[model samples]
Target: MMLNANLWWHDVDVVRRPPLEGDTDADIVIVGAGYTGLWTAYYLRKLDPTRNVLVVEAGHAGWGASGRNGGWCSAELPVGIGTLASKYGRSQALAMRQAGREAVNEIGRVIAEEDIECGWRKDGTIWLARNEPQRARLMAKLAEEREYDIGEGPTPVDPADLAVPGLLAAAHTPHCAALHPAKLAVGLAGAAVRHGVRIVEETRALEVRPGMVLTDRGQITARVVVQATEAYSGLLPGQIRRVLPLTSRVIATEPIPDALWRHIGWPGRATMSDQSLMFPYLQRTSDNRLVIGGRSIGYRYGAVPRTNHRDDERAWEVLEREIPTMFPALADIPISHRWSGVLGVHRDWQPRVTYDLATGLASAGGYVGDGVALSNLAGRTLAALITGTDSPANRLCWVGPPGRRWEPEPLPYLAIQAITALTALVDTRESRTGGSTGLAARLMGIAGK
Candidate 1:
């Protein structure tokens, strides 16, 4: 079957579910079939065997960002240590980081226990510094990690180790792993079904209220309703600003030859990236393909898509240009796939979990571009809160904040466009001049505060 959204699904066989027909009533209702919804459904069944759970999806499972991501299940939270420390105190901030690391391992544990066939490798990730500004930025992050003992912070690696050109220094951390994203998503959906959770696909949820969800098919009334629609949450009534849908584009190259692999010398297959404002993330597929993603190449005006295609030519051009610049040795490699997907971005760019006991409404998202692992973390937290388990994951610092919505229409659109343009300009200027440009530093300062 031809993959609808991503290269990761090209060879995998997905089991499809028919759309919901007629009105349905359940004990728990989820509004999205992506990772968050499926994971929540899965855990709810595991926690309470008698609860009637139903999941509704706009497209197939994994059709959203869950299927089209960089595939680095990194141990990084959406928020940084210092920011978390300032907001929730230092100990809670440290506990948040520890929970993130556990979540990463938990993904592996669950995949193995469930016998999911996703290609998973615990090879870790590396951030390369190709310029002085990038090197300084990398070191600044490292200094903070070292100061706080925040797990295995980036370690310095030699330029020769990466076999890439113009590498000043490199930072390596074992806190990340590479996986086939679509496989994990589809696997989770299948696993949830096997555990007695009902999932309905191709069912668009128009509105999600406290105890009911209005869908294209029909209405679903349940005791508890979860608005798990990450990027598409804007489409719902009264949630246009809960999260902004920012487009992230990616391209995958044909399998490289063994001789080229010898030159690349990435036996560990570490997910790689460079330090740039508009930086790219890299992953080597199990089938030996190269997949890379560029950040926020296109922004949806008013948090909505302008076209159905969603793919941007400028973003594709950036991938083509950056790949050769990073590795001249692989300049001859051909791009096999080009696809784009949008991810949710909070105004503060922090991932959060919100649940109201009185309303029986809950949500977990706003992961920015780091949702792959953070989504799993959000799933566990949402499950605990819904079931009244009183677990540590539910009480974490990220769960307390009632995230402010985005600015009104024209303002959000304008702000996103200006930030994207400014960041691109900053990256360009920093690449040319090795001096201490305060562009990224200033942006970081403002964002953290």
Candidate 2:
């Protein structure tokens, strides 16, 4: 049940403490000490080092997807601006969007400034195409990128140029990056401690009544409470409804040959993914292993560990079969480690920051799978929102909640399952057919609804 790096954010040491045994007070109280909460403290201390900030976690720090994720520090390409603009507004969307891009830069800056060695990479992202429709979409998307002003070439990389098999094309993006996730988390926790932020692990926030957060062994009073729990937002009131969770799985191949690395010309050995709705993502570790994973939408977010455990064969099955399909030279590599984590897929697939100014209670969630970059950006932004600072965090486009209600169609859980199954079935099947899923596939994309 411990959510440490038994997954692939690589290894790191997290400080563990027993539950709070009594009362505490701080200027800020952050719940769920993953990437989001920790960054909240890290930045808060940066802006005002003298203030007391308490970070409480249900588990160890970064033990959630922050520790277990694929380690790709990417921008908000996964979610379209249409989603962004609709929820928050053009300026806010642009700011939120820019913040995600800045998040990666901030990470590198943090590592260098603080000298935290987290295997950070500034290479880029390559999204492979399984079939021609996917390839054509990339070609179109690359062209589309110019229109959206996502900077330079999201252009297609010919499969022939790499002498790889199976893949027809890959949209190579030079702006993205990767990192050793858990290492960054532990380092930040250490860094935050240096700045007077108090972090307590294994301390669950049992209840929140405006200024006081009650836990089993202790309670902390604050003028403002920020809930940074991304995956397990269900623990907080009204949070679970904001983000619809999808359990995504990842597996690392034992390590490919140096020959393969040379072929890919992975500049800084960047992170990569595919365009499939069930996105197949791959990135090279500092040690040369290729870690890849895709979505099995049929599985609920919470069941990833149990449903896709290493021995179940699907872990290796998905990676082995899918990795080489994206990069055929990697077709023979064996898997060494495998893990899964639940990601909060915010409705409309946009990252949202919501706070009731009257209540001074805020919750940040719904990064979809863009938590690595978006979460950090959101954490800092949430802190600024709470402190009433004019920091760039709030300038980002995604600054508020969905500000809507979930009109549950038929039932809650059952409807979600059926939609997931249908979407996966149609998406995977259409992917095999090689082009866009057409109108039928488009409609099925909402099967969960």
Candidate 3:
């Protein structure tokens, strides 16, 4: 029973493969056929044409966030530039930022060269500040970028120019691209298969040990075993504490008329987000619909939610409330779809990609909510690590160690509840006073760093 949540399905064609039936062995086996796993396999075959690679998935390919994201293939990393600088000198931080920018362009290039019909657009992204606290945060971010000598960082835009109501200010960057996520995922999967990568769907991995992966039907043995399961990693043994799975929900409105779009005046199709703790991201789809998503949806215990369901009524209410506040022009527009998906969040909130050659095991995940472009970088870097090739991505600061495990049961539950309550309180205060009651936001920033 697949969830009927993803709007990208309208344009994608899916081919489901049979599950792993008997004991299988390959040179390398990848668990989880999402973007990370598919891209890794694609690069692996590209690098070594003869290396035997097999990808096994619990569901069909692109069943995870790879197929169900906000579709902003933006050049954003979960780790901040300032944090990277403070950890590993300014030069290394700048190099990492450059690598990220290159990765963004690389995605666009891949889509074009492969001729994936994902509605690729590179109008860039706009960060709108609708209130005083948001403006301060944007200014602080600009100052940090300037300090790091980031020439292509966000540039300020006056509210008068944007014409968005309640827009204190806005920033623009040309690095982010928009595309249909499912199209890219499906296309990549097809490319990997065409490149001689074997893919087995409906094979649930129960445990991932060094050089061996235990599954519901049988076991797979390989020289290298790569765990690409992001949020669903908790289902495997000894992996629950590694990440906290948080739900992110999205809603799309019916196609709006050209007249309504002109009245709104945002024809650039730039991926847009506001300065909120529960950051809301909006996009103008190629078909003239508006898709909005946020992370205020509730979380499930032990990082496992109902797998076959997509309904999140509370999340729908949140988006419904926010739509009127942000874009009054679409107040009466009917919602066409509503869905939710979970993403992995490290305890420290930084994304990680780790490979251990000694154990013949590597895992790449914990992208927080920014896996769109980061997953591409992770796939390429993981390939380099497995093949012992030295690429700039392999040398990135995020490549060495895995994330620290989360705290025990009661702690994660209590902390998340408290944090959600605090976030709501802070949002209310900021909205009411239009002032700097940004303690919650500041704490979250500090924790992620």
Candidate 4:
């Protein structure tokens, strides 16, 4: 199997849309036709059919992280609820949580209304704790959620029922769903078109100016310009330090037989992950294949973003080893695919949706690795702000002025490397000692806040 080929694109044949010809004009010109841009375009047209919305893409729609992610349409935010409360306020934090849960349902509703068969399932998520240290962390998290009176926070599940080996404890949250990411991206693009939004594929957006977007094909003048180029934001001029691009890799196994599934039971098909600092996330695909991903390849020097990382042998090796360790029943299963994608991470690790009415500029991203569900919310908020629609989404915590830009090059590169190394070290130490690493708490404070 090709390491760079996305598993989700295995059976889907994608036809590129016509690129923009010469100069053009639109009510909204959005750069990068990933989830954020496409959703924004979809909502813009839905909210006001008269508005001319144009989305220019470097490649086919969803070619970025949107199509290549872990297939988790989860309500999990890049920052935790407690983190949000401390930074904003308790009510605002709760609202953000509610928005996330609502976003999950909103996506499902859109998928159904569009009749897009993308293997959508609302089976929820299960987070396992394989060691005592990890269990402690999960317990503490549950305690915090209860203290805040968060709605139906994760509840404990018996490890024996999950069938995963060495699971000391498990917590399941009903706020997530697993689906084919590429299918959703392609579906959204089709939906946007049906809603009268113009999308130009294979047209690279060179730069986003105040009221215009300069592309490789030509210039597009618009009343409002949006930069929706998540991880690739660093590649744009004047946005080199805006968001650090962190690489995460994935490996998918061949379909597991029914007999093997009995030994590794996840009949609910819920997305699963462990509580380790540098853990892996897994999901049972609609086709019965087990897809596991994580073990970040860290950030590249100069914050450069690329489509392929064929040199990520170490990360791939780690993931390959992880599958068998987690589910011994899959020890003989062959990994059918391997791929990597970059996700945007803000300095404070909080995603944002910002619109500046003065410059007619709007942006949304920095989702870390949680863009699937959050992007939908961001798109609605962006549309509301652009179309002057009175929506509560416009008041979410993520809708505001952009946060601080990441520190210049070498600094961010070094910091990411240090953090990655510390994460691995903490997990390894905890696994060996079966005790909490006091440093884990401090590391979370630094990495998250």
Candidate 5:
């Protein structure tokens, strides 16, 4: 097994495509071969097979957060529905939420149509409330969902169903699915290739300009250029603060025995996470291994993005401790892998899909770690916008201007660290007292807005 390699990567073999060798021209050029880029490329050709579409990747496809994430294809957005309604109006917020739900099924439809076998399971997600405070928060959220009449919103589940210590309540929502992220990424790349999309791997995009993409290999001129780098957007010149990069670490346990799994009691294998401020997300792999991940690390100064953090002992240590703490049955299980990846966070904590017809520049990202399903929506929306499809997706709230840029360095770095530290502290206080800290709400307002 490779150190710091995504556990999902273990399920597939990666072969790099030929890199760009010289200056080229295309109908559409997209930088970053992650889900957003590949999905856009896949859909663009689907919409119009005659268009020349090219995708350039710094590494191989799925090398970034796309392949390294927690494998959650969830409809949950980074910001809450209420927050969206407050900012973009109620109808638009509801429309965006509905779009997310549809996006989950859309991904499933594509996977089945493409015949990509990536352990696709629509088992949904389970959110655990481990303390009184967490329970109150969950109930409040459920009430809000009811108030908005969101379809199939989270419903209560018996805490006993989770079989975790101190669990006071649980909620399940069908709008999430679990899958092998790397396999999905690789498979999408293959699907795009089959659809006449050219993917150039190991080609670093230096900068993206109007109708042009400058790369290490050569310049690419196209009628339209899309920037889908997400967290790595900071690596490009003049985009240092466009999106902040935050590190998330993950650890995977060796396959648990059938008897032990039965004792643990998640028969559906629904993706699971607690309501803790520094929450940890868990998933059961098709092979029966347990994967857990969380935001165990804070932002780096200057928003630098690193491919691997194998040397980050502190982050891995935090994740390693979570397995035993959350599930005593796994106390002795060996952790087979540990890895870390960076996710993009916009200033408003909302994802966006923007296309500027005047400059032939387009972009979609800032998913804040909830991008698996959202990326599909963005791709379809981007394709619709670029091809003049006049679809309803273009009317979604995210299909407008890129929101405010993150504050200059030191400020973002400091604020992120403070929030991270405060979150941990609040979780600790809530756990010990079994009462509301009253700080989480304040923090959410400041952090997301």
Candidate 6:
């Protein structure tokens, strides 16, 4: 049922498969079968078919964020412009942005070649603006994005119409795209199998201790172990520092009629809500429903939220009232469903492509919410590193885990939820009063400019 509601990208032939049994040994073993691992396996096979690759999942493939989350196939940097310039410098940032731009195209190519039925829409996206401060900030983003060598530039809604306008600004780029993330995940799994990559589901990897992964059903002893669990990265290569878990959410509006679509003017458009730190994002599916996301909260000073469904429901309510506010016609519309997932966030919001110099283990995450595009780059980075290719990718430095530099915070679930609710309360007020900024925005880094 949870799976069915997220149907825009599902395929009948790609239903969840059975789990693995008995001991297994392969040349390489992968943990977590979400987008990252699936693509890793797929591309690895593309690199070599007879390498004896084995992949194990805690649940069905795509069951995590892969199956039940927003399908925004974006290539833009989710990290703020200021951070990108500060860390990687302009040239490397440009390459990172270019990788994002190229990812959607690569995703499309793989889908087409495999004949996967996931709804793949290459239409551009819009960064819907909601408030005055947001609009002002967006104006700055538009200019700054132009400065960056983004494959495409942002289109502003200068003096945007908020009451009737979907957003104060609609940042569109051919580089960012959308698709049924679930189907793509499943398709990749199936493709991996076709390429001689064995996949195992319903198996939890309890421990990773040098060449052996202890699973509930059995143990996997392999030569190489790759930790593909991005958001839930830890337990392997050690949890990244400053790379805390952020709970983001998504919800689908009842199938919007084509007439409403005419009013929205985004049959081919998607939107990212504006926030210096974390904010909401929305887009039209291949079908006519609006899939909204980006309503998120930082991990309890340290721990990840276990009940993102509840958080997502709360986020859905925020969108329910606000999405209608964006377009009056959408006011009375019903919401079809909602779900949530966590992302790996570095302090600065850049992804980590960390390869432990001490250990043979290699892992990457900290994409913040930009993993869709950046992970592809990480895959290439990983392949290059493994095969000992001397491409420029070898020099890339990922956000190392913040364990030694930072200590974990003890998060009491209820208090953390309250903090999130408080943020939304302030946001609701700002959204209603035209727009907002200043202290609150700065706290989140919206004063990003």
lDDT of each: 0.83, 0.69, 0.83, 0.87, 0.87, 0.66
Residue-level lDDT of model 6, residues 155-175, one tens digit each, is 554424333553545565566
lDDT of 5 by residue, 1-449 (tens): 42555688776899779999999999999999999999999999999999999999999999999999889999888888888888889999899889999999999999999998888899899988889988887887788788767668777788786569888889899888989999999999999999999999999999889988999999999999999999999889878788988888888888888788888888766899887777888889888889999836657788888633444667788788878778898899988888888889898888999999999999999999899999999999999999999899999988899889988868997888888889888888988899887798787677452
lDDT score, candidate 3: 0.83
TM-score of each: 0.96, 0.88, 0.95, 0.97, 0.97, 0.87
User: Model 3: how far is 229 from its true place, Å?
Assistant: 0.3
Instruction: Kindly report which residue stretches of model 5 are placed more than 4 angstroms away from their true locations once superposed.
Output: 1-4, 307-311
Instruction: Indicate the TM-score of model 6.
Output: 0.87
Residue 335, candidate 5: C-alpha displacement in angstroms: 0.4
- Superposition TM-score, candidate 1 onto the true structure: 0.96
Q: For candidate 2, write residues 1-449 as lDDT tens digits.
A: 22212544445555675667689898889898788888889888888777789999888887787887788888754566544555556655566556667888888888798887877888888777667766765665565456456455466676665544566777677667777778878888888878888888888888876888888768899988888877576555544455555666777766667877888665357677766655666778877877776656434433222244443355446556766655666666666666667777554555678776777788777776677877778777877777778876675556765545333433444766766566566556757676465744454234221
* RMSD values, in order shown: 2.0, 3.6, 2.3, 1.3, 1.6, 3.5
Q: After superposition, how far is residue 85 of candidate 4 from its true place, in Å?
A: 0.5
Candidate 3 error regions (>4 Å): 1-4, 305-311
The true-versus-predicted C-alpha distance at residue 183 of model 3, in Å, is 0.9
As for TM-score, the candidate ahead, 5 or 6, is: 5
Give the alpha carbon lDDT tens digit for every residue of 1-449 in model 4.
43446799987778589999999999899998889999999999999999999999999999999989999999888887888898889999899888999999999999999987888898899989999989888888788779766667777788998677788998889999899999999999999999999999889888888988889999999989999999999788888788888889888988888778777777768999988887798988989999999955567788888634554667888999988788887899988898888899888888999999999999999998889999999999999999999999988888888889887767887887888888899988887888887889988788562
The predicted structure with the larger TM-score, 3 or 5, is: 5
C-alpha lDDT of candidate 4 relative to the true structure: 0.87
Tens digits of lDDT, candidate 3, 331-445? 8988888887878888777778888889988888888777888888989999988988788788888887787898887888778777777777777777778987748567557
User: Which candidate order results from sorting by TM-score in descending order?
Assistant: 4, 5, 1, 3, 2, 6
- Scored against the true structure, residue 304 in model 5 reaches a CA lDDT of 88
Off by over 4 Å in 1: 1-5, 305-311
